[model samples]
Target: MEQAFAQNLMQAAQAVEQQVDDELNRLEKLTESDIEKMRNQRLETMKQEHKKRQEWLANEKLTESDIEKMRNQRLETMKQEHKKRQEWLANGHGEYEDLPSEKELFDITKKSERIVCHFYRESTMRCKIVDKHLEALARKHIEAKFVKLSVDRAPFITERLNIKTLPTIALLIDNIVKDKIIGFTDLGNHDDFSTDVLEWRLGVGGVIDYKGDLSSPPDNNERKKKITVFGKKPKTIRNGMGGDDDDDDNDAED
Candidate 1:
């Protein structure tokens, strides 16, 4: 399934590139007057679209037939959204991928415009928790690439990117690191933080393109409570894991 998705995106990208090349070749042959005419045509098209939108929303003066037509348009819009989502899935945007090789990370960053990489250690409990939320986010936000890299396997990248902490979510755009979220500090200091908390954090970093409100906290009432007896008391946690020195050392060894 993933192979098929990737192939579809490659085909689409190639088609777009061909179109761009053709347009550039045509532009080279066109005069300045031709460019101005094309610009005027684009402006007129935008004006028509804007007028249609106004009519779609103007309920006061709309006749029954107009309302019925608008309702059908709304249904068509919903279908279009579904089709767009399918296209997104086909473009390899709907799953949290655990990259097989560290080299593949570089490939993903180059091909994908926006990427969220969770640099995690296998033994760390917090990293596992982060994986759960990230998996959910990958399905929800189909606008960015979500992936994970094992700190042990990706030694060169881990050192170069300065990913010293467990569960470090590195946000990258155009292969350049834009932001990093180390530990659960930004997320309320707890093991059971909701998916939206992580989603909101990613949204803040511009990794995910979303329009939903991120201001409100997830209504996890037990955020202040400890999940297990071994877990630390609910308090502010810094870079280090909330567990003992042995646990921190274990994560560092990765």
Candidate 2:
């Protein structure tokens, strides 16, 4: 039994040695063509990998170019809008003007694309209130030209427009009367109306471009009414302080 076990171990050792000798002989017999084929296969694989990398890089560059194009277009549009606003400021559009004569009013209306002309009387208090709001609006809305024509100075234009009211805001486009605000009636009929209300009213006339939402209430939420005396403040009024009675009083006061 010991002799048989020793014989089996010797056979296994011989088998392993023969397998190694066979692998070494096979490697020694390799032809130049076989080695060249292996090199070519590796080179082909590297070329394929390089082509894929180049394609990915090209796609990335195209995406970056598209983004840059959009960015430049947006910048150009913003620059054009700014230039237009500056031109408007240079052409007497930013502030309110007081036209002295009917000819001046006509000339301004003809030159300006849009105009908000307030016909006022010096003696009228309500007209003074409108002046305060319009003066502020003129500075803010530079797109439209704001001007005031005193009924005393521009008598011919006043009669032609049939403006009987003390403070009538005429919205004109290319010298044609598009609309009119016949006093505080269109402006919530109150003395203490906010600038936002007046702005909304003018926006309705399409003379000025108002930024606020027309569907919503005025932006100034506080102080709907001005306190006349140190006594108790009046109740919050929505549509106007007084009814027809207040309007009659306003007419007499005007």
Candidate 3:
């Protein structure tokens, strides 16, 4: 009876030990699964953090203050250029620098302190008479500038100024059209005309301050007066002839 009891006790002990080993194996598998899950969660969190950092870097750029500063710089540069242009104009560059082209004419008439423009046609005979007077007046009146604008060359300026006559004189003061003199209609119909008559007429129009005698006789060039040099050789006109052929010129004059 004792031997049978001892064998049965041994078998019971072995079965208990097997049960303990099986329980241990089950706990080990559960612990390993929990560790793997925790590792995957940590890796996903790291990926999200990396993505957020990259987004923050990408959004970095010029701030509002930087953009505003750039705008201010541009405005300052424009102001400086404007000041320089005004200074250039103030230095009397507009007084002497005549308009070189049709494009410059408008700017000159609008910007110059005082401007006198003679609009004339090339083939017109009256244009020469106007040019002669303008040349002499320009030399005498240094306060005003004289400019010649060809009517044929500048059709746009002619139309813009509303010039109808072949020889038109337009005066501008402070870049504004003050007055205009058209044709020789003011000089009267007499064939013999004087520059004093022209000058005085312009004076009447407030163009010049010349108080010279208006009724005085005109010069020889203006009146084309015949100077009777009795029995004398005529002086040679050095106009590209380069020859002092007094005999031929005297005979021609006779």
Candidate 4:
């Protein structure tokens, strides 16, 4: 009986030691799994932090090219505005004026980019007609200063210009005479001419493109009709006379 009891006690002790060993193994496994999960979470957080920083940098950064393009665009805008202001100030800095003094005429030429001056006589009907056209043009082309000085009032300028004609329209650029709108023929007869005739004459000054249609009499249409000039095809824009190439040597000969 003593020997049987001693064997049973030894078996019980062995079983207890095995149970403790199994528990220790389970605890080791759990600790390892927990440590792996923590490491993975830390790695994921690092990746997320890196991605967020990259996005912030992209949104906030401006490249050299971007800065240069913005600067150029603003500079161009400022240049255009400055050019326009200079022109406006050159044009009496206001609306068209019947220049009160001859000095004002000289000042206008000195200041403006373009000059369209009408040498008018109060009693002359043709001068009156030209005045109306000039007034309308002044409002349209602000880049050019339009002046109306009475020939009787501004005798020195009239004599200097040698403007003997009753109504003379002069277009000057950079203080030099470019073209003179000569007779009443290009403009209709007597006081009947319209603003369009003046616009047509000023086309050479780069103000407008004359479409060869004048506000003249209905009979003038015959001059503008589809004509074969120089035995060639007609074009889109025309000489003031006709839509065809009127100035072509062959057409002029015809």
The C-alpha local distance difference test score for the whole of candidate 3 amounts to 0.60
Position 161, candidate 2: lDDT: 63
Residue 245 displacement in candidate 1 (angstroms): 26
Top candidate, metric TM-score: 2
lDDT per residue (tens digit) for residues 37-118 in model 1: 9999999999999999897778667889997998999999999999877766776888999987689888776667788899
lDDT of 3 by residue, 28-66 (tens): 777777878879999999999999988787656668888
**Full candidate order by lDDT, most accurate first:** 1, 2, 4, 3
What candidate 3 gets wrong by more than 4 Å, as runs, is: 1-100, 190-192, 212-254
Which tens-of-lDDT digit does each residue in 160-203 have in candidate 2? 66667778878776566766677676666678988888887677
What lDDT is obtained when candidate 1 is compared to the true structure?
0.74
What number of clashing residue pairs does each candidate have, in the order they appear?
Answer: 0, 0, 0, 0
TM-score between candidate 4 and the true structure: 0.52
Kindly give the stretch of ten consecutive residues in candidate 3 with the minimal lDDT sum.
245-254
Per-prediction TM-score to the true structure, in the order listed: 0.54, 0.60, 0.43, 0.52
Tally clashes: model 1.
0
Please give the lDDT score at residue 88 for candidate 1.
61
Instruction: Evaluate all candidate structures by whole-model CA lDDT and list the values in order.
Output: 0.74, 0.73, 0.60, 0.63
Q: On TM-score, who's better, 2 or 4?
A: 2
Candidate 3: the clashing residue pairs are: none
Q: What TM-score, to 2 decimals, does candidate 1 have?
A: 0.54
When 3 and 4 are scored with TM-score, the better candidate is: 4
